[model samples]
Target: MRAVVFDQFGAPDVLHVATIDRPEPAADEVLVKVKAVAVNHVDTFIRSGGFRTNLATPHVAGRDLVGTVVAVGEHVQSWQVGDAVWANSLGYDGRMGATAEYVVVPAERAYPLPAGIDPIQLVASVHSAATATIVLQSVMQAQAGQRLLIEGAAGNVGRKLIQLGHQRGLTVVTTSAPRDFERCQALGSTQTVNYAAGFESHFQLADQRFDHIIDTSGKVALATNLGLLKQGGQVTLITAPKTNQFTFPVRQFYTRQQRISGFVISHATQDQLATAAQWLNHAFAAGLLLDDQVSVQPFEAAAACHAQLEQGQDHGQRLVLVPSK
Candidate 1:
């Protein structure tokens, strides 16, 4: 099996396609013949030694994959050979990655691909959809009709949050560039505010306050958004710069019973991943979550793709790699 392997953490150049021994399924796992895998920022982060250091040498770094089951372990009765499946919890936490000719996945973590869904699009949506599902459904436990605000709404995860929030009957407001307002609205955002024009001013003018606020940009200051929350509201942070910091408004935060929490999809438990997979399958089948701007590249181009992503050259396009047979 030719897999993207990195012997030591460094630059994107450290990644290369190498023939490695194919893995066999454990008692609770299945062997998947790789079709397509999505390259994520976290993959580059781990590759560059910015996140998760104690990795085994020659690590593979793909988190989402859409593939066909080639074999199943003895205890795995739910799946069998030829089953089309997608998984998002790979390439992290000591697990072998999906950027290979073949990868092994725990049976419970492999989700059946929705009928008629494209493997490229399905692979692209898994990471973002799973993060959105965990954040909105599991972490926040958002209810229908609640007001929600999403920062950086034009990005992948932010867009997922808007679509899922709208589907669940929430009033979704988003902050993004003025050019993206229409795009966000088309994705189910009820309102879009120009972040450059100042979100605080827009909300103040509209007298808007949300039951929940999520900063997908990681650049939005918590103190600035706290005033935009309704009483007893909650704020969720999913992305941010490593050195970013803000002064806490302790008095107001406590007085209003406002709460702030953070979530990384990498930290999601097996059960949480399963829950996300179910929602993602339904969303894909309904044609509600699709990435129209995906760039399909050869599997061997992993290193160049990583460089493009790190250099901000991807232009918000989801990059999918198809393994060469």
Candidate 2:
């Protein structure tokens, strides 16, 4: 099978196509014929040698995939041959990834595609969106009628969070540029604030304090956003960037009984992954997902993808490795 392989990670050039032996599945695994896969921000971070401390070298580096089951191991009875599957790599250990023509996934990690869902775009949205949903629910314990703010609302996870929050009856507020304002509103965000000016002022305009804040933007220098939190509210930091320190308001509020937490979807239980998947499937089925904003690229253009994402204008999440038209 041909795969975009890398022995030493440093740059886009390091990722190239190579013909390696196809993998057979273990007794509890299935061999998937990869149809399409999406790149997570973590994929770029790992490739640039940023995550070298945790993951070793010489690894296949994709996190999410959509594929069809060609063969299932003898021990795999939950899924049969020819089932359409998507990757839920949360429980899998090490770097067994989905960046190849074929991937061997434990039966537990392959989720069956829901009925009537687009098999191609399903994988593109499900993996990242699911991770975001479960992490928010676990970290924020968000309830309906509470004001929830999502940073980076135009991005993949943030958009899904907005939709999920609205569906659950929460008052969803998100920050995005002018171009994305209409789209964010359509996704169920009750309020759209432009990040270019600053978020703190807008929060005050709304006459509200956030019950939960999920920061998806790596930018953490904004202090006013912290003031938006009321007493007993929580701020969940997916990226606890060193540059973004706890401001005076956060410190004062901490003394007054407030909590701050962090969450990542790198690890998930089978039940969590399955539940998240179901939630995403429902949202997509309801026409609430905005994955079509993405540009689907060819597999061979994998190297160029790095440069495209480096531009970082948030053109939406782009998926690669599906056969080009």
* Top candidate when judged by lDDT against the true structure: 1
**lDDT, candidate 2, 175-263, per-residue tens:** 98889999899989888888775567766876788888887886745455557778887777777666656654546766657777776
Candidate 1 local lDDT, 1-325, one digit each (tens): 7889898889999999998888989999999999999999889998898887455335877878999999999999999899999988887777788899999988888999989998888888888888998999988999999999999899999899999999989999999998999999999998878887356887888788889999887787788789899999999988765677777789999999999889988788999999888888888899988855799998889999999999999998998898862
In model 1, the runs with Cα more than 4 Å from the true position are: 53-58
lDDT scores in order: 0.88, 0.74
TM-scores of all candidate predictions against the true structure = 0.96, 0.89
Q: What's model 1's TM-score?
A: 0.96
TM-score of 2: 0.89
Stretches off by above 4 angstroms in model 2 are 53-58, 90-92, 220-222, 240-246, 249-251, 323-325
